[model samples]
Target chain A: MITHRVSLFVAVVIACAFLLFDRAEATIFERARQAAADALSPVFEVVSGPVSAVRDFLADIQGYLAVHEENARLRMENAELLAAQAQARDLRRRNERFAALLNVQVDPTIEYATGRVVADDGGPFRRTLVVNVGNNDGIGRGQAVVDEHGLVGRIVGTGGHSARILLVTDLNSRVPVYVEPGRRRAILSGDNSDMLRLEYLESDDGLLPGYEVVTTGEGGLIPPGIPVGIVAGELNGIWRVRSQTSFDSIDFVRVLRFDFPQQIEIPPPSLPGQFIGVEVTPSDSEIITTPPATTDDEPARNESDDTNVAQPPSEEG
Target chain B: MEAGYRRGLGSRIARGPAIMVPVLVTLLCVVATVMPYGSLQGIPLAPMFPLAAIYFFVLTRPTLMTPLGIFAIGLTQDLITGGPIGLWILVYEAAFVVTSMQRVFFVGRPAGEAWLGFIFVVSLSAAIIWSLASMFYQTAIPLVPIIGQMMVTALVYPLLAWVFTFVLPEREGGA
Candidate 1:
């Protein structure tokens, strides 16, 4: 008798779930569900705060203490970089002049909307992030996100005040990437790992395990040449692109206000509203100097008053 | 407060709101505290609190452990952790079903037996969850870390079970 009842109940649930799946979005039930989600999300955030604080305290304490050592190492590396910069500078000048000679008018001019990562959507199945900048910040759907390291992901959905970025390790994520220096094309697919698989590549490309992959700029989802990672160890002879940007524990990020088919509008200054405060640092060189501290009570950023005097007019060389 | 307090003496975990509520809150808090999210590089210790709670409740009072209630709790986990919407629901159902079936075996057994059962159940549940997630993701994700999580969960079962033992102090005529 119990078995019979259980089967019937299971059958009903399966039927209902199937119906829900078929309708997809725009259904009354879906709206109600999303509405409930929207309402409850803030409450969830409140509950998650203690955990976040503890995590932040641990990650930051050790990280900040070691920053001085990292800085010294970086400074020494920067000195070496300065010496090499002269050689790279000449090469860039020649490359730029050559590009000018070629009349490279149609280069993929990147227009980026800088934003800060507010929350880490760190579960196993879903690897995403909540950026402070959103629709109000001219953050639209399908904009490519990149960090200093390389390609993070593209925007899947946007709230009014914030947007959710689907990282390269998410199940739903896919980017058309090319094995660079080889000109071989393949789709970089996410399967909930730090490394993403390179799928659907032509066999003739002679792809190796350690080949570098980058966005092909094919679907306009991502700009080309944003370093996707080196090909990690292959599985069943299929290579995967390990993303350069470890969005693993990143606390801040930038979202590019990119659009395709020409005419891209980078977000203007003063884009942020009162809801989310993002530190729009003008340069990367100053993050170590000070990127203001944010508490749970208030979001962090360098106060405009303190930072305004630094850059008025540059001494044009 | 009630739950933690009652398990020590002549009180019933089921009858005391103090014990039950605190247990629920503690379960939630413990799960929240050391949650492993993100990629495999830094998965937290996974002795899942809800799994422990569900086991205790079903073993003690099956009526108290409602499917919809468990489903709702799992929903909260999914939303907060940014997992697939129905993923935890399926996982909870699987766990619930197994516990419901095996609950009879746990009655009259000492706390240690329950703890062992919990470890076994948690490992089984983690395996199912890992497999289901892998299937949904369409890849053979590594089992090493997942195995580690399950092992951690099993090891932590006794502590959490001890906490549960307080809330639902199993005794004759307690129900």
Candidate 2:
């Protein structure tokens, strides 16, 4: 009996060590698991269909129950949205004109494939969801997944017809983000809670509550300017982000396709015409520092401010 | 080919439910854990169907619920749930090992005793799972959902036991 107990103990310890050591994200076991999941996805889809349908039916009934209040809210929102749309069109036109004046190439277009959420890891340990689109639909690992509101997560594993999305609320998620109005950079990390924590901020610089946070694309993984969340609150020096996307009722999601540029180096000037007061790198094209150094500290600060406001239309070699 | 022999073969075939019931119930429990149930809409409401089923079989039909079968069920769950491979295997095996050791104590016990035993075993199982998961993720997962899962499993244990026994009766000549 003692030997049997010792053997079981040894077996469990060995299993734990094996799993801990086999920590590679992409492994043969993971591939086999993905294949198994792909094979069983049809069953999951069939099962989830009725559940989602019933949820929709219930939601519709609730909508009818609160129809009057909802109509009032929708009408108010529509009026605000109409005004915002006109303002956005004007800004877009201005942006296009500026791009033409600066001889800037068109911004890379973002393409997307839509899919339905079929299942979630129903345990307390992780926040992951399986969507019905996979590599067959241009869904690849590390592609951003978003809902209508904002960024939701990224694809971590892909099968033939299904993919797993590791939600931004998962403990493993880390997104480099830019806090708007101030442009303070920070890392948004999840701890399996409703709110995400802002980490890696420089000392003594704090973000105000409700400040907008968007993806900075510093890692070149997620595209820049995708809205992530707002600073909801802070506790014990950790700022929390209230993600714009609602994970509770996530039914459909869009997988964004963004190809990161290969070469970031700028070639040296070949001619005087190509030489300008600014230099451009493919990785961060928006930022341009003055080519010449000024000994006057005040003037240099002023020029830097001006550079931020209006990117001088100078060609770079 | 004799008439009496043919009659015995037919009787054995008629006892197919007796042979298939435990395995089918266990597999169904595994499937139901990952099934999209509406009541499990929000919050990490893990499906504890397997816990209840395992508890029932461990108490009533220990021989039918072998260690290898338990291990297979746990591994399947881990693979499908997309969690660390050995997590559920460890949890399920711990539960099985503990219960199998105490199976004799549960024999011929009253329903209350069985329920009490389930409560104790599930709490131990939940603690083991919580610690192992926390270790795997390198952070402490919240305890609320694990506690909720344990409570729900314990509350539903009697129902599962009743169903199991009803489906597979304890005849006077039972194994």
Candidate 3:
């Protein structure tokens, strides 16, 4: 009994030491965490199989039940989308012409590696998920993860066969977002709740409930123009955003492989009357070049020049 | 000679289950706790199934689930959940020690009394974890999900206890 009591006391002390000393930013601890995750990835994958099968079965039944109403809704949505598609095409052509005339660079198309979520750390304190795609699948830390809906989270740690996603609703999550229609910039912060808080909005003018919010891509860690969520409501005088990506039903996700652009020096025009029409650098060309489509079996190659692949930006608060 | 050989083989087989069953069931509970139940909406947090197992084993077969074993289970949960490393360790260890101390009160009592004791354990665990996590993050963690998790864990404890008793009927009286 004494031995048992002493062991339990020692365990408590060890746990306290770990809690106090293990910093999240420590390299050793991070690697150890990722290694542990890799070791358990296969088990998580196997365990999630039956759960996925049951979910699919229930979904099929629900779909069958709601087939008629869903079909009608889809038909109406399709008709509206057809009209919107034509308008969008015309707008895209005009926008491209304007961009070329202005010499404004277009954002690169983001290629993503898809994976299934095998584990969900759903609790009050931290919100995260373990995805099956990892370093082997070209998934890296700081990559943005999205479901069929919109911005879900970003990769925080990666192992050989698994990666951890820090969800948007986590307390530590801070996303720089642009609130439309005014394009008002604000930091979307999470408080470990369903709704995300909008921090540092300069003016609330025209920032009503139901306004759209999206990534500004100011830091370049995340790609620009990914839909995040809509402004939900104001609480305690703080505006909140309802994430488009539903946390409850996140099954599969795509980890985007986006490389931020590096600064390039442009040379002066040598001869007189030489119209130096905005010297497009190599990086600019790389950004404009369309990458080949890749399937699940084929990982997309990083298209940026070796020297120009910028380091991931520091996380914003 | 044939009868003696059969007796030896039977003892060997029995020993295997005696050692492996509790650990396997506990591991299964850990896996079930973290499994992605995306379709199961309305409940935001998964119940602490492993905790239920710990409570049950600590009360019924204390020798099988040593302090070291419980610590390992807690570490596995922390690693899998991607939470703080020692968060669940402390929680589970505290639960183990407290449950072990109160084993006398629960040993021969009715199943309802054991369940009430489990409710106390779950509440204590929830308090410890919520406090530790809040302190670790340097912010006040929300209480709603913790309360929900506590309620779910307490509600499911009797079911797991029943299952354990049904599986290990002989050992049920060993506490």
Interface RMSD of each: 5.2, 3.1, 2.2
Which digits, one per residue and each the tens of the lDDT, describe model 3 over residues A164-229?
Answer: 998888887877788987888788877777789898885798778767898876555677678898
Give each prediction's DockQ, rounded to 2 decimals: 0.20, 0.32, 0.51
Model 1 agreement with the true structure over B1-175: per-residue lDDT tens digits:
6775466444444456643453365346434532323233634333566777777777876655656556666655555444455566667667777888788888888888887787778778877778766765457766655666567667777787677665664333544
Question: How many Å off is the CA of A52 in candidate 2?
Answer: 2.8
CA deviation > 4 Å runs, candidate 1 = A1-37, A40-91, A102-123, A130-136, A202-212, A232-236, A262-317, B1-47, B78-85, B134-142, B162-175
Give the per-residue lDDT of model 2 (tens digit) for A1-317. Answer: 45445655765775676567545442546776677677778888988887778766766776799899989978976896798789879989999997777765554698999999887776766778888999899888788899988899888788999988888888788877778758877778877777888887543265577678888765445777899987888799688888867665578999997765533333344333432224655453433333332111011111222221322334555
In model 3 chain A, which range of ten residues has the least summed lDDT?
Answer: A292-301
TM-score of each: 0.66, 0.78, 0.81
Tens-digit lDDT track of model 1 for A62-137: 5798899979978976895787689779979999997666543445466677765545543334566666666777
Ranking by lDDT: 3, 2, 1
Score chain B of each candidate by TM-score. Answer: 0.75, 0.81, 0.83
Query: Highest TM-score among the candidates is held by which one?
Result: 3
CAPRI class of candidate 2: acceptable
